[model samples]
Target: MTIPAPLNGVVPPVCTPLTPDSEVDTASLVALVDHLLEAGVDGLFVLGSTSEVAFLPDAHRRLVVETVTRHVAGQVPVLAGVIDTATLRVVRHAETALAAGADALVATAPFYTRTHPAEIAEHFRLIARRTGAPLFAYDLPVSVHSKLGAELVLELAAEGVLAGLKDSSGDEGGFRSVVLGARSRADVDGFSVLTGSELTVDSALAMGAAGVVPGLGNVDPAGYVRLHRLCVAGEWALARAEQERLCGLFGMVGVGDPARMGRSSSALGAFKAALYLRGVIACPLTAAPQLPLSASEVAAVGKYLAAAGLL
Candidate 1:
């Protein structure tokens, strides 16, 4: 499935706002969508890692998708995240996103099972076939150990079972392999690659990627969108400057600790905190457990944002 042009550029897997009671604050969530769009993001990736898809129930996920889609009204693509550990649940959620008028599916492989490539290829092949929509493989091995092997990824693309892969696998070699392999098939149409690592944005673009899917975009949409535009316009030096500035921000927002309390509990919540400081979201709470930043971290992060001119 080809991406609608409006869907490119810095899209954030936007954070979900919650009520004081910690339910899916529907009104705040809707307002958050408006905020992200107003922030000049190209699209919304609801129910993604930043949205804490793992803890979100199917009903809440669908509601989130429906609300974001209705909120956007097709003005921009809404790539709903489907991180089901089970392929059937993946299928279920993928179909739900399509039914909700979403434009694509950002899927991860069987994380719980740590499935092999052949298994992953089959899983995504079936998921893509079932949904009849474009699939962007979310290949980050941080949450789970084995990942979608690049060879199998290209093989799936060759077989027409997938559209693109978001290479958060975090191995520069793997990212290089994905780009080199896909660009080799330039003779074919509709094959693309999106980088998931914010640190690798410049490198990925130079290595022949379609674009990036960095979490940094969650906070600095304008900055990274300018970086992307600069890269597109052949201004690599200027682009790298923005990339580095945004890269500095990622260190804080990308942190995850097994031991933490308060609102900024996880990387996802930290990202929402950045968005909160930037006024992109109405609140900085996740749907479950909730990620709250430490008081000191709040001040520290605020200082950095001011220094970056993001605040």
Candidate 2:
């Protein structure tokens, strides 16, 4: 299916639920997909940072895309993240995901190596040439260590080499520049610019972002959907209130003790725990080498859910 020219609305980066043995739990995954779809989300993005795609093996990643795409059954676009360290590796993942029924692909810049902006541009261009599918640039400097510049993104978008961008770099100024540039440039009319910021979604949308790809949406899809609706309806005051409420609910990401685990472990762990508490998924286990939330941390997530009326 053709990805919407300007893919808009709330598209959550769906988490990959795992069994106690660290295998992809198909049932839990199906339930999680249904949970989001029922919440009125516009799309599903799998194998993203929130999905622990960096930690998943190739086989597991394939299973996730295949499972989600087949189960979604075209209800909404399913975008698979081709997150890898470099060009060739990303190409391989892109091929696999497309074969597995993904409608489009999202990719980050090369990691584990110091790369120039030109090389990053070439990397995306190469993937676009090879995949022949809708490709979105995932700007995640925190993970990739390379911030995609607004000028470069605009150049690529105008060239029709990039269908969209998902900015998670946390640089609001740069994001605003891209949002405005994409809007003013006639050559990039169909370029969809999405923000991956849960905390600043309303502002991003107000600045002309096409959509949001919030990781927090995995835990509270309805809340994010409501926030997006309010923004689209131009209910700025109510949208700010809803966004602030979600920001408060987002504090669950801090429940895990940082001394005991890394940020990914804590944030992703909190999300899964919340899902489990909400009965969306069966288990809260993340992939290996990541610490699971303790009992207290799980209880803390429960409290956040209750406070947000999610429980």
Candidate 3:
């Protein structure tokens, strides 16, 4: 299926389900996809940060893209994350993902080594030229260690180098600038501006964002879908209420003790735990090196689920 130029609605960055031995759990992954699709998500993003892409090896990443794309079977657009530290490596991943049936690709700036803005632009340009597929810029400065400024993004969009943006930079002002800039430019049509923020879906949609890519959506896809519809229908009051309820549910991400684990562990573990508790996935185990949530932490996640009526 061709992705809409401005892919809209809730597009959840899917969580990778793992077996006890840390291998990809194919069955559970399919079940998780069914859960999101049933809840009305517009698309699926596999091999993203939420999917533990940084930890998975190249083979496993390809498995994820192939599995999700084959399972989805044209139901919705499957966007694979071609994230790497340099241009050539990213191009290789993009090739694998497209060969695995991914409809489009999402990528971030090259990282681990310092890069200049002009070099970053060239990085994207090289990828676009090499892949010849629709590419969306993933502005995740926290992870990539470099920001994709609004001007650079606009220039790329105007030049047809980037098809859209998944803004996870947490800069509301910069995000607003991109949304407004895209609107005012006649040469930038079909440029999607999606927010990756879980807490501000309503605000982002209110400001002309095309959609959302919330990690929390893996736990409650219906909630984000409902929130998106309410906003699209212009029901601000109802949308705000739904967004607030989702905000409360999102508190589950902090259930893991900070002293023992990093935010990635806490957040990703909580998401998987909720999926397990909700019986979507069989196990809540994250990939290796990331600490697992304690039993008490899992219980805390249950409490948040209970409060949100998910359990």
Find the candidate with the highest lDDT and give its number.
3
The Cα error of candidate 2 at residue 278, in Å, is 0.6
Residue-by-residue lDDT tens digits, candidate 1, 1-311: 23662234667777777765666878877877776677677767788776777777777888888888887887777888888786898898888888987888888878777676678778888898888888878887877566777787888878777777777777888878877887676533566677777776877788777777766676776777788888888899998898888877777753445566542365666676676787656677666666566666666667768878877
Per-model TM-score, in order, reads: 0.90, 0.99, 0.99
Worst 10 residues of 2 by lDDT: 183-192
- Ten-residue segment with the worst summed lDDT in candidate 3? 1-10
Give lDDT tens digits, candidate 3, residues 248-271: 999999988889899999999999
Query: Taking the tens digit of each residue's C-alpha lDDT, what string does model 2 give over 53-170?
Result: 9999999999999999999999999999999999999999999999999999999999999999999999999999999999999999988899999999999999888999999999
Ranking under lDDT, best-scoring first? 3, 2, 1
Report the number of backbone clashes for model 2: 0
Error of 2 at 264 (Å): 0.8
Q: What total of clashing residue pairs does each candidate reach?
A: 8, 0, 0
Error in Å for residue 199 of model 2:
0.6
TM-score of model 3 vs. true structure? 0.99
